[model samples]
Target chain A: MGEIVFQKPKSLCDVPLHYCPGCTHGIVHRLVAEAIDELGIEGQTIGVASVGCSVFTLLRA
Target chain B: MADKVLMKGNEAIAEAAIMAGCRFYFGYPITPQTEVAAYMAKRMPKIGGTFLQAESEIAAINMCIGVASTGKRVMTSSSSPGISLKEEGISYMAGCDLPALIVNVERGGPGLGGIQPSQSDYFQATRGGGHGDYHLFVVAPASVQEMVSLTAHAFNVAEKYRVPAMLLADGTLGQMMEPVSIEGITVEDHDKSWALTGTDCKRKHNIINSLSLLPEELEQWNLERYKRYEKIEAEEPMWEEYMMDDADVCVVAFGIASRVSRNAIKAARAQGIKVGMIRPITLWPFPKKPLLAAADKVKSFVTVELNMGQMVEDVELATRCKRPILMANRVGGCIPTPEQVLAQIVEANKLGGAQ
Candidate 1:
């Protein structure tokens, strides 16, 4: 059996998320983190948690 | 981010707005700034923001006004003709004291003149573009980087002062590509106490209209708005002085023309000429104090611009005609080369520039 290794994006924090099951916000958040990782500009980004459900995504990140 | 990335001025404005927590954008497409709309169109949805391409520039600005009244960050961008079309809503925004970012990637002419880079909209922008005595806090970004910083800064200023602020850039600055750092000083989450978030029985209903039709009441609102404008002028005069420490000739310019003049100053200085520059980062505040001080020291002034000397009048007012203020400008979409400005500098020097 091949060993499984997990690597998280540097732009995303390692924390448990509270998004609803099968919510698209999770995918959106991961893609945002992935883009930030790809650009290698995580430190320069300012994440704005709007007054909505995505505010939790900001918190989880 | 501290890391610099190459970006067009228009796209930088869009990205910077996102960094500034602007989730609402309403604009119509017009060159040389449609990239702002395009960028927002792509990014806003991903961030759960609204990016609406309205029917016309008129509809776009009204949509911005609607979003701004709700106390969320919103913006709109247009070129010369499109901005002229949206003047009514701009005035309404000013009258209502709504916080919104209005960007004018300016081009030439009194009408739908030319699409090439020009600074012909200085008067329309600085003066009331819309009717009434209301003022827009006009900011000019000479480079792609400034298009980001000043666009972000416009949101802060607008929210703080509860007024509409304009990011005034010409076509050259809009289309030009340069490296910009998109890190710190971008997103600022200001308290939206004045926004019309639902009362929920906790506070009074917030009124967000500019229609105080009674003569006495409307006059009072005008007076109050004037007071705020005065405060802005007093507090927000921003500029950059280059080589003015010992410069004999002080060159006045802004936006793309200032960049050209900067190169001219550098080249002329290598030839032992004393030419300097004063670039106003904030067009509304106009940086009169330092300009007056430079005018006191320098013998004469050379105003370089893409238009036929609209800003020279403001410089004249600042200097009070104490020195000879000459202009080297181009119109109908032609930007004068550095050589042309260098020649103008040599002429101004010979004509008692820094004596």
Candidate 2:
């Protein structure tokens, strides 16, 4: 089989996922991170996370 | 028709709140401002609004929190002691960026103080009585007419900034009766897209909690809130100047004290002493720009208040100590007479002249 090329998006920080496997949370996170990176406002943008599973976005996102 | 009617100050404020689209009212009974609740209770339901006399001031403000989260106008009124108890909830509202109107018809205080008019709460209102670096949009109404006008304005300002606002009237302004013109005044329109009604399973859920546990996240929130404050200060500073042109002395006052200072300023000018008055309508922004401009035209400044010279600090800071500042103060539930303020103005004038 041919070698597969896969890489994590630079918009998200390199950290192990804290959410469960097949949680569908990583997909939503990547979408938002991609938007922020595309808009070039990653420096000025602020993301607020609420209680529950979203608290993991604090330092890892 | 510009109809005029005689109404007590407290009742006028309550009517103005209803006219300003305040659909939810939650407050406990306190002296001097009890008329506000009594009026709201009789009037709120008649207008298809909600009036809840909560078990305590704390409970009343928390109820206000719930209503504000729903993006509808809510209000609560209390006297000084009751306001002290409401500090926690008021700060929480600020933290949550909720829009609500809070009225403090102040009485003498320190601990269950006398039920008399006093400006002792000036520092409390201007300096974020609750907690954190929050700043309230505070309005000081000097007359019965202003009691109506400013109450309506407070709600508009509150909604615009999404910050809690205060109508900081003293006991006298709340209890006195005068002819006020509220003809055809109605609640202004507002956009409630930010309000938190359940999404009906159509949109994302909204949370109205004020808990930001991490230090860096909380710091960012505080900075964003202060950016709004800076914009408000630039756009919303309001004051009224009387006979300030070509004056050597200026008398600064607000609320009942301003009424007395006006009499004193008239008397001082009658005796050929150059005196003027500045009535601050918004207490938080503190009218520093106009006051600093006034400093250039005058050599002396004096402040009149019902407290032991609390607002004098603001005057000194505003004037930058370039001019001498004097205080005409009365405490223990008593107010300074016009003559006392005039004496201070004259005294300040002499000192400024010599220097």
Candidate 3:
């Protein structure tokens, strides 16, 4: 078997994503999670979730 | 102890907040209070603190909510119009029971009112300026020295009660220069067990939120908050009584109007009018006890204010309308002078114990 490497970033939670299917919000959330993981800031991050669809951003995590 | 130094009221408040161990300040610049933001911008970096001039008053207050949820001291300052913009976040902070400081160095306003000293925001500050059953611990400082002391006091009380607090000043208080000593202001520590420090997967995550879909739970939250507010009302109402004894007339005022009232009161005393003043230091608690007590001894009341009869309503409520109340007021960026207040005192004295 090929070496397994790709996985969800630790900063991204294990809960099911609430975004609409095929929505780019999930993609953006992943990118943000990746950045926090790469910078090793998961333990130091404080997300200010705003109103609207983005309000659920931190709640899922 | 430090020597008294000349400082603007806005600058004194900023320095006093830093003295009280507040390290994070978020604000947007507005007239008469922009100096607070300017001072924080210059000083926060040197003290290893954070100062961010957010894009708007709303953004600045939200940043305060963010920092405050982390169990860190935070504050935001704005004028009247800007404060109206911040009311939503202020309500959220109250609903979430987060401790933060909000300063409204008020300018006249029903809508984008002129940038002049006015106490028109009294109702907004004291009555919970947002759309909810919540109250901010509101303090009105009459002088630059009180500005220094009350900044620390507001922070301490906010932390102690886990509620937002407001330092309600006006354009005159914000712009006027006075000799102030910002020494010996101590910051009391409070528990932060509910703070949103990252869990590191060690425990259940803490959520700092104001939203609740369930009506029963929301009702319970508000009830619980009011219980705390009741305790605050019982214990925290503060006012200064100047020559209240042996006076036939009592003048109630706060902030700059109180200053004007003092001069009017002295002049009235000289004229044998037997008038005194009660200056409320905490607007929310409203200093009802003293005013109610004075109602028994005084025949009439005069409320001096920079707004058109805002606090006069509070005075009537506090005194229970036991005595006839007169309002000496100026609105729309205008302030009542000592002579104007004295005239009201004379008018109240003429009523002469007539219910």
Candidate 4:
């Protein structure tokens, strides 16, 4: 598998994924995490999770 | 600023809200607008933000109110029916003069109209959805790009005016995909001096409430709020005027419908129809000045919408019947296409050029 490369989000900590195939959730998730990383606000963040597919993303994060 | 990437309107709004320093998101599941909630759910946690799916639309908006009271940037989103359910909470947020972002990817409705895009909520959004005399800073984004850009602007305006703001989208706008870029966003540094994050020892305790038992006191509060609105009307009104300089007919529309109207204007102009478009970027302050100016030059105004003719009334009031205003619209999930709009332009031209 050639070391199974997976990059951790710049601002977001490494976490597992629970998204369906072809879902753009991962991309959007990265963008938000990258934005926080760029702004340097990782420590003070407090996220709330809604129901549905977002629940998995929230739990993983 | 770089090459834009393809993104859905709902996704763009979520990304933009994060870039704008929004730290809290509370929303209930609803069709069309579910993508916004979905995006926020995945992203908020990684950014150390709050994302909660409230029990209902009412609870969602109230959560936003509570978060906003703490001077934290918060948002809530829903479809038309759910938005109606949040009316009371929306009014309360307004009464308290809390700054927060609310998004309604409107669907057809007097009640649970459908899970399809509709502009039937135009009056509800602009006239104040909840009971009471108040105005929300309403921004109507006609494209996915505008969704991204205006979501950021909505937060700025809300914070600036100390009032709840709205990003009014329709099902088409929420669902469609387009390229967008959010390159240079500096969210770390922002002004939050006016936020009610505990008054601290430096000032008196900050209380955010919309209640005033005394008639005279209530009157004073309302008068002050109206002044804020007047300043917003003067300063925040925004619109896109396309080929309106010498337009014989000016078509006015917003949200997803405006994009279709833009296409129609292009097609009509290609045929020497001399049609143009006035796309309102902010629906609340309603961009009346530019519309009134366009009315003076154009012979007629065509109001294109997804619903029967809700915003047409506003156009008429803005133009003050200086010109004849015609409406080309669709209902339910039905959308008025470019061909339909062009047909309307031809009819409007025959009726009379510009009034």
The TM-score of candidate 1's chain A against the true chain A comes to 0.74
lDDT of each: 0.86, 0.87, 0.91, 0.84
lDDT, candidate 1, B1-355, per-residue tens:
3889999999999999999889999989998999999999999999999999999999999888778878888999999999999999999899889989999998888789989989888988889688999778899998888888888899999887888999999888888899998866655567777776665535544556666437998899999988888899999989999999998999999989998999899999999998899998888878899998987788889999888889999999998888898899999899989999999999888776332
lDDT (Cα, tens digit) per residue for candidate 2, span B1-355: 5678999999999999888888899989999999999999999989999999999999999999888988888999999999999999999999989989999999998899999999999999999899888989999999999998899999998888889999999999999999998755556566777677755435544556567668998899899999999999999988999999878998989889999999998888888899888888899988998898888888888999999888889888887877888889888689999899888878877876423
Better structure of 1 and 3 per lDDT: 3
Candidate 2, residues A1-61, lDDT tens digits: the string is 9775855555677778888988998888888888876777555444556557776676453
The stretch of ten residues in a row with the least summed lDDT in candidate 1 chain B is B198-207
The i-RMS of every model, in angstroms, reads 15.7, 12.6, 2.2, 11.4
Q: Which candidate gets the maximum DockQ versus the true structure? A: 3
lDDT by residue (B234-290, candidate 4, tens digit) is 999999988888888999998888888888888898899988889989999999999
List runs of model 3 lying over 4 Å from the truth: A1-41, A53-61
All DockQ scores:
0.01, 0.03, 0.46, 0.02
lDDT of 2: 0.87
- Model 3: per-residue lDDT, tens digit, B156-181? 99999999999999999999999989
Poorest stretch of ten by lDDT in candidate 1 chain A: A42-51
The residue pairs found clashing in candidate 1 are: A44-B1, B1-B182, B1-B183
